[model samples]
Target: MIEDHPQRYALVNELHARPFPSLTVPCQAVYLAVKEPIEAANRDRERDLAHLRALLARHGAAHPAPGATHHSAEIGRHVLKWESHTEFVTYSAFSAGLCERPFDPRGSEVFPTDWLGVAPGKRIAAVLIRVEPLPADMSEVVTKLEDWFVPESLAASWVLDEAAIIAGDFQIDPAGLMRFTVFARPGTGARRVGRIVQRLCEIETYRAMSMLGLGRARDLTGRLNALDPQLSSVVAALPDDHRAAEATLHELLELSAELESLATRHSFRFGATGAYEAIVNQRIDVLRETRFMGRQTFGEFMRRRYDPAMRTVKSAEHRLEQMAERAERAGELLSTRVDVERSAQNQKLLESMDRRADLALRLQHTVEGLSVVAISYYAVSLATYALLPVAEALHWPKSALTAVLVPVTFGAVWLMVRRIRRAMH
Candidate 1:
């Protein structure tokens, strides 16, 4: 799929195919894309002519013929020289111009903005070179060019497979494509060298855009909690679901996982680690907010609901205990009352039984007294009858005897009543 993309694949192939001049010897190059139609091309040509005239004037070569004078300008300590070639100009003078800038003395850094008329999709493209004279041994020139242009720190196995056409191990095809045999150089210093080589090799516009993208990513990540917020918003704003959120997230994660993938591919590093650290710090902020919410919710639950429920339970338990104690006390009081009532009832029953027993004893004593009186009266009647017989025989005082017997009977009845009372006692 990537190969089918003409723009991307063409660009990649061009980068690989082009001959990267040796930076150790100082060189400059530019890749241009022409955008205007035929009519606009003429205007672009006029503009280039005017720029050339300006260069000549600035370098004090204004009176020289168009093809005769090579304009040269002093930029800082280095001299920049511009001359016409068959199809392009040796623009290495621009680098010299950059070196002359006020801050050039600080380091060997190239600033693209210092160029006079460099822009994307311009009508023309060119590079320039000026180096210390090449070594007599052509092999040494090829070796040095390979080392200067391609740093081994980035690719340990990047080698030209074909045999060298040049004695110095450099080969060039008819299309102006040059290849060099390269080997890995391992050391801590190799990293710095690799970086320098990458900058030298890359197109200025592409490198600048990449830096802008990284800056944008950093700023966006800084404001948001997690990458999710940025991702979701971007996904939502998209025209369709063709840019799948899940897929995008996966891609993002993959990008993050292989932190050095792009750097490795470009043979350059783009502050990726620093950007990732910023993202991590943003995520930590999100985590802190989540933790705060959790703690707050739990605290509210405890304060407003759970604590009250527990207090209610405790109160209910206390009330139940009080009720149970009250019931127990009531039961004890009732039991005491019942015992007192039962004792009173028993005392009444005992008093009624004693009265009945006393009445029964009195009735029995009266019956015994009556029986004794009856017996004594019968004995007196028999004695009276015997006395009547004696009187008839004697023919004297029968009436007087009967009277005496009656009195005796009376006396005897009274005595018997007294005797029965004594026996009952």
Candidate 2:
């Protein structure tokens, strides 16, 4: 028997998890995503599960297992799908009936007000999706769409080879929820309808999530503007500011630290923004949309309105990276200059020491010459005194005797001193 890997089953099940909801026509799905504004990714998953249980308890529904990332349950007349993500949680309720009025808040009755009040996080995206069979006259959809949405921002498209017509204005309705209408053509499978509904919800959810970076980008722009002038001044003064070399270096280090700090604080968000933006684009692309009745498709809508904000985020990210690189390069150049100056100063110090050593050696040689002359004078005096008696006995002159001994004594003393010096060496 073969032993399975520990995570084999778990990994396999993960792929099949969160299956698409099987919904027939005339169905409504109320979708909502919630997230903690700060430190969401590190939030306690148990609390999210608890919140999900609270909602399920309201309808007397069964609870999900512990550590579940997603769950689906029958709550009253609707099926509620709950999914937990890295930074947020989503709740989707599907019912097989639509309200008398299209995109009406009454269709979202599955989530009671009291249940939503105690939610653990803030609502990031909320949407009301209404699915129905396409009517015979396409002009009716146009008329109803104009009345239901702000026409200037409306995007209507035929997706999946005209199997479905989806429309939305991508704006918040008076009831504070995004509205999406999916009209499935005849013979469209229930699963296909459900997939389209899911995609619509995902598009809006990811779109809302991705836009969170816009505020960060704008704030970063302001900070960078303030820092630019300071950085420029420091760099410009480097050439003439020899006295302030250390001070300038210090200032450059502080500036570099700040830029690195900015990068650290926002790197995760910027990276996550790019990922979410890509997801939004991919989701829309999978729909394979074509323009309907001259209205803009989702892609075109994003290019005009959404792309600018995304571009702003990208521009800020690029500018930050470029500035950081410049700071690093400037630091390197300054460090090299500092090193060169230090080396030159050290060379001058070594030269001064050499001059002092030469003077000391000359003074020592002069002292040695004086010592030899003094010793010879004493030797001659002592010898003359001892030879005075002999000179008297031999009838020799004291001056002549002393003169002869003077040269001899001096020569002997010089030889002795030289020998001692050589021995010491």
Candidate 3:
């Protein structure tokens, strides 16, 4: 066989990892999403695997293969599909048959209480969906929907080219579950029904997941508000005195650190939120929704409720970025001020040094002149002492001798001093 890349087999097999369940009409399902802390990305995967195994063992079902991220198995009368995701794990239980009552809460009973209690993370989203045959009379379906969900908040749509009708208020009920109902036309394939149901469940789950970002954004608002004025004051103080600028720089450093910390803490959550929101929208789009009974469609409902929340999240992210940019600009300005001040101080220092150097040079010249005078006087006195005896022998005048000797001594001393100074240089 030709040599193959080590990951080729795994890479090719990944696409078929989570096969869509083949679900028939007159079926019910309970969908659950479990999430840990925002740091779920770094959480231990072994805990999740062990939890899955525990549930599988309870049902006497075969365990998922090692290193598997998704699994599907039959547990008693229901089908169980488990998918591990980046921040959470989802479990979907599909049981064939409808309850005697409309929107029965017991439909979720397929999942054991002990099993759910031992799930790896907190349940973030729990939904109950019912798939039924579309009645020949559309009015009867509309009446039932109104009875089930609040009319003002209900969103109903005919999806997949009117092959099915999907309706939900997207509200949590007293039972702590969001509800969705799908009415598929007769002769619709089981696989098609499953895809529709899965998309509907995904739309709800992802929408709720994305809203976590909005909650984070709201929590950050108060802290951000407090920081805003402090930052503004720092920027405003830039043009002030050196002391003020220095203080502002210190404050800016602290503010920058706080901003970075906040970003570091929430960056992953914000990014994950945006990704989940996009998936929610994409899932809805695939439904190919159309208006039902002149009521609000899924797209319209999201545009009203979900879009605003996402916008708030986006706004928060943008505000944080703007603050960081502002801090950076302020830091640059502070640095410039400090540099300019230092330059001015250096210039003054240089001027003072130049004056001191000039004074020292003048003193050196005066000292050289004094040294010449003193040397000449010493030389003239010594010569007079030696010449006194010689003058008597020659019978010459002492006054003339002394004057001539003084001039000659002065000249000699000046010449000698100049020669020494030149030699030293």
Candidate 4:
């Protein structure tokens, strides 16, 4: 029957041409990638083949049919092509998981265990089962599956039933390709492949949950920014003695970097097949980086990382304003004290103080205006000083008195300053 189907030979040939990572299990590996309406050509298929090859390489596995005998089966109403070995299987999607099952199992006396073992080492059986729909709900499905394959009591020998295998599985890629994974225990015989499939399913479920968490985090970050317009101002206002605001900001930045790293590790790239693995990897990365603290500590870190950082910034600003007010009050108190101390030498002291205050205020105003005036004056003075020596060298009028020319020099300087300022405006 297999020899008569030339298309099966073509399929096997194609699978062998691609790179697939070889697993130690006597199981079949299945990877699914969505095909769009535009990609319904031979060229597109060739491209998809290349992409699948890359995905297998990333997972540290090789294509099973490379120079080896294999079997081919069309799955999901012929929407997916499956390449199978004695122990392993690989499924490639011709379309998204949208195919209808052509045949019903009512008349056929197929056992649940038989159906479970049909895919061999393929870790995506749970996903396929879910998509096909059982005659019962998930709970009933689990119950029926447990009846077929009993789980072991010992951790070392704990066998997976079909229901336990399917519970936590489902992954949707960015391009909307969903993959289910199953994990197998070491040396658990053929049934280990079922465990691998179950693990894949669970990983998918967690991936979806993590994505929800990420969305919530993003929303919270946006709300924090909206609630606090001037984080820097708030930070500046914090009490002079309190440095927690600055520390909080630094910690929040560090946390954001950590989250970004976690997301990168967890996120599946376009055209990648292993969404479940990516999510699991990302979750593990985050847990490892965060050091698996208590739930309260994790919550605190999140709050501090996002909202409290803004609060710290606001606190800093409030403190600054308070400091400014205190400084102004202190200056007034000092002035009153000085007035009380100088009663004996009142007239002399007051006159001296008054002159000094006037000079100080005038100096402040002069400094404020000095940049333009000083620059212009220095430029003109340099030119005039140079002219003084030149005039002497040329034996010009000695009565010119360069020092007396200060007023004229200042007038020219003022005009130049005005011109520059006007040009700037």
Which candidate ranks first by lDDT, i.e. highest?
A: 2
Give the per-residue lDDT digits (tens) of candidate 1, residues 90-164.
Answer: 333223222232122232222133334442123332222222323447566445544534332111111112111
Question: On residues 339-423, what C-alpha lDDT tens digit does candidate 3 reach at each position?
Answer: 8888999999999999999999899889999999999999999998889888878887888778879999999999999999999
Worst 10 residues of 1 by lDDT: 162-171
Candidate closer to the true structure by lDDT (higher is better), 3 or 4:
3
lDDT for predicted candidate 3 compared with the true structure: 0.89
Q: Write the per-residue lDDT of candidate 2 for residues 221-253, one digit (tens) a residue.
A: 999999999899888877975556778889999
Candidate 2 stretches greater than 4 Å from native: 241-243, 371-425
TM-score of each: 0.23, 0.91, 0.90, 0.21
- Local distance difference test values of all predictions, in order: 0.38, 0.91, 0.89, 0.38
- Report residue 402 deviation for candidate 4 (angstroms): 96
Question: Model 4 over residues 348-374: C-alpha lDDT tens digits?
Answer: 888999999999979865774786567
- The local distance difference test score of model 2 is 0.91
Global lDDT of model 1: 0.38
Best-first order by TM-score: 2, 3, 1, 4
Work out how many backbone clashes candidate 3 has: 0
